[model samples]
Target: MEHEEEEDRLSNLPKIILHNILSRLPKKDGARTSVLSKAWEETWYTFPILYFSDGLFVGTFPQPWEGFLRKRKNFIDYVKRTLLRFYDNGLAIKQFKLSVNNFELHYMSKDVDHWLKLASECGVELLELCLPDGPDQDEEGRGECYVLPNGVIEVKSLTELVLMGGIRVDTAFMNHSIKFFSLKVLSLWAVLSRDEHAIEHLISCCPLIEHITLKCCSVLIPNVATNFLLESDTSGVMKSLNMHGLLKLKTVDVQGIQEVYIDAPCLEKFCYCPGDFDAPFKIDFDRCQNLKYLDLLSLKSSIITDKWFLELFSKFPFLESLKLNNCRMFERINISSVQLKVLELSNCSNLKEVNIDAPNLLSCVFYGGGGSEPIISFLRSSSQLEVDLQIPIDYLDLCNLRESLQNIKPQNVLSSLSLFIFQPTEDALNPLVFQVSSPPPSIKHLHLRSVPKNEILFSSVVNIILSSCCPATISLSFNPFFCTKAFIEFLYETLMERKEDGCFCGSGDTRCWWHGLKDVKVTSSMKIDENVDFKTMLELLGFGEEISFTLEV
Candidate 1:
């Protein structure tokens, strides 16, 4: 009866369904499940997925982690048993994953050999070996290496393979007879040999490759950096995907992976970052039907335009978020995201135009331009947006901005606006007059950076602000440029008098009293030696009662 029931269960499942179910099981667990019933007995043996995790056995017998790792024969025995059991079961594997760690380096090779032998015989499709990510810290890229066993020579079904961290991958290990490999992602910090010919042999052999990632990888005879074709490389090819399966490519993420060929239909998320700027890759995403996210940072060079960016965005049917940074010469971005939530633009010095139509955008930052005019104009179209308009004092243009708030559909639903204005120059006098004319009524937090610097008399300017708007917090950046000995002496003298009168600005007996402003911060660049000025600035702001370190970012 038990024997008949097992046979019935095995016969009921279709081959593909049986393959998927068995794929989820860990190699050890899958093999052991054969004892459950007679149907599973042979099923585990012929299962198509073989997963080997060295971490699993390490965790099974846990002790306090010491820097010292012992060579335990028992540990080796445990892993050997698992590998032999899988080999004995004789399952044809669809995917073989081997993860090696520091603790198992001594004995993992033995167990690894057994696992590969079984996988090769059964035709493993996806072979992956992950070593610890130690390559990042070492300049020489020195770390442990794995040697494949002699019995593991033939794997006719291998497809995707990844070697990361300290995995010592040489030419011979890659010369397997596997074709339909759709992807190969490698993060190589160190190469045992920079043999470009060997690398080429490996890639050329796998014509089915579509996606490849080599973070900080240094290979390719002519250097991958030299592989950029002005329009498209006539030799442009998917190294990992079959030509028959070229359009089936999806995504490629690389480091030092300079240029990539994107002639795929199903390609989705493409993240390519070259740490050095002089060398950059150009991708054509026109045919990619499902492309969603494009994160290109640490990209060294590329001529950028709205048309090129728009062409990239058009590929994704449901893309919502996009971030661009560290890219120079790419100016004028007109954004129109149907479902974008946040748009952040920073440090793109050449970024000039921002024409956005993202109605769903809830937050915006004009961190690039310090003058208040462009950002305020940008937000004028936004109904109620939480904004950080940090405009430096000299060129602030809030002329139409102060009154535009009334036009928002629901007046002032937006929470807060942080404004930074400097008034060190005589030309700053005109904008100072403009500020007092229409002080923001909903101004929640007012940050005054470098307002009282170089012994500059802020007496009149202080009175106008005190009578106009009430601020929650006032911050000061006593910059190094104006932090002189003569400036400090006058500032110290004025601060003592101001504090005695219970106000930062001279006239404070009105509703807009400086006394009401709760937090007052005084800070400078860490390199600046402002020990006397910083101490006295805090005293003047009434923060001497409770010292506070403030930095204007």
Candidate 2:
């Protein structure tokens, strides 16, 4: 009689709380709980996320992995019991993950279709079906796309979907009656484009999609990105997308794509790059109002001129961060991003000068592809309203920077600087001439690539920086010639002593910008700089590296 009363109390526990507990346990173990009695029998089915690995089930089965999985689901009565209980719980599933590798091909796609259909019927929101290996039997010379039935694609709530390596994947589902699918993220891999209209048909049906990522899928120029439109009359929101390795793509018809408008009011970031520079393409996001971040590998403007830059910025009113890399024909860059903060220009072949005018600018770096002369000229000519400038030491101005040091117009703000000093020229010409022109008011990081000549030996160069910028912490680039133990020790002690003198050690309220350089980062390419490690610099900077600092949102 006491036992009966205890069972009654267990049965009366809140269903929602019990469901959470069972969902957290291994599916197989959770199934065993159903055997506790009839009341527990119906609890397993309520578990929303079912993680069943075929390798896991093989341990309980009498036969090997393939034979066990090929058999009926009920053959392993425990797993069957778990699923039965899971189904009886009447809980809508949010995510379903099947962790199985080398899935036995002895089982046909029909078998997979059955289980996935069960998940579809249960309304799983995220279906991550991953088959890392392709089928062992090589029938088709090329990979084949899936020929899915109409019933499987009908899951209305599924927003995130990943399909990689199983059958060939052709997105014919694009032309299907796609309904109730407000899918936000879609990742497709190894899919070919034999059909002429495959890409266009697939994207047209996605009524509400924000992001698209394509990787490892090699194809011809059949599906061009320029053909898609963001029409002024249309009401659609697609904000973020990543397209990589569409190798042969030759052109993008921006005029046609302009008609298919963006519906995402909050769209901020986009990454799209034509694999080749000469690959015919056109990019026009004129209608996209709220775009903030753009990572364009190659902007194939017919001619890159000053007028073209102004027109591009005119389209993107709120553009902040712009990255231009590997563009050979791009000679002059005139950027007028009103809200721009971080500008990273790397490996622009013909890039001669940069004209940047932004009030709230924080950081700027130019990794000139062996073209330091043109960059230095721009640094000297640009407006010096006390902005933080990081240049290859060959380019800095010594005298002018030192004069403006103490009472910077934006008095409280610290204009942090980073220098990459090239080996001094063979003549009396010191690349340090640039340093004399623009003395860094509050230099934080100094990365020296090649040591200056004996005339401007390492110590004298260090003295010049200490006199000009007064950095709180410093990082010297590691090189075979200058990377000796004795030199590092002397440098460390000198920086520590100077830091104690209260030069760059503190600049009140300037923490907003220079804080990222709290200690110092001495990035090396190949060899080890065993002499002065980053930890040694952190010790001098007075901040323990172990404590983590969190940024307030």
lDDT (CA) per prediction: 0.48, 0.49
Candidate 1 lDDT by residue in tens digits, 1-553: 9987776876578767765776777666767777866556666655656555556655544575552244344455654565566566764556767666646453355566665676666666677766653322233432234544433324445566655544434456565564334334322333322243434345445555566555654432322567531111112111221112355445566545445555566666666555554534555555566666666665445455777557545656555556555555355666666656555554555665556666666765544344323322342345655544443433233333343332222334334333343444554554233333433344454444434343444443444343333444333344444323343344334433445353433233333243344443445434344555755544343211222232121
**Candidate 1 error regions (>4 Å):** 1-72, 91-97, 103-111, 119-127, 132-144, 147-160, 168-177, 181-212, 220-245, 277-290, 300-321, 329-333, 336-353, 359-553
| Candidate 2, residue 466: how far the Cα is off, in Å | 6.3
| Backbone clashes in model 1 | 18
Per-residue lDDT of candidate 2, residues 263-375 (tens digit): 34455665555443233554444555577776656554545567877876787778877766655545666677657776666666676656666665565555544434233
Q: lDDT, candidate 2, residue 206?
A: 53
Name the weakest run of 10 consecutive residues (lDDT summed) in model 2: 544-553
Q: Provide the lDDT at 488 for model 2.
A: 51
| Candidate 2's TM-score | 0.55
- 181 in model 1: Cα distance from truth in Å? 5.7
| Candidate 1 vs. true structure, TM-score | 0.48
**Top model number, TM-score:** 2
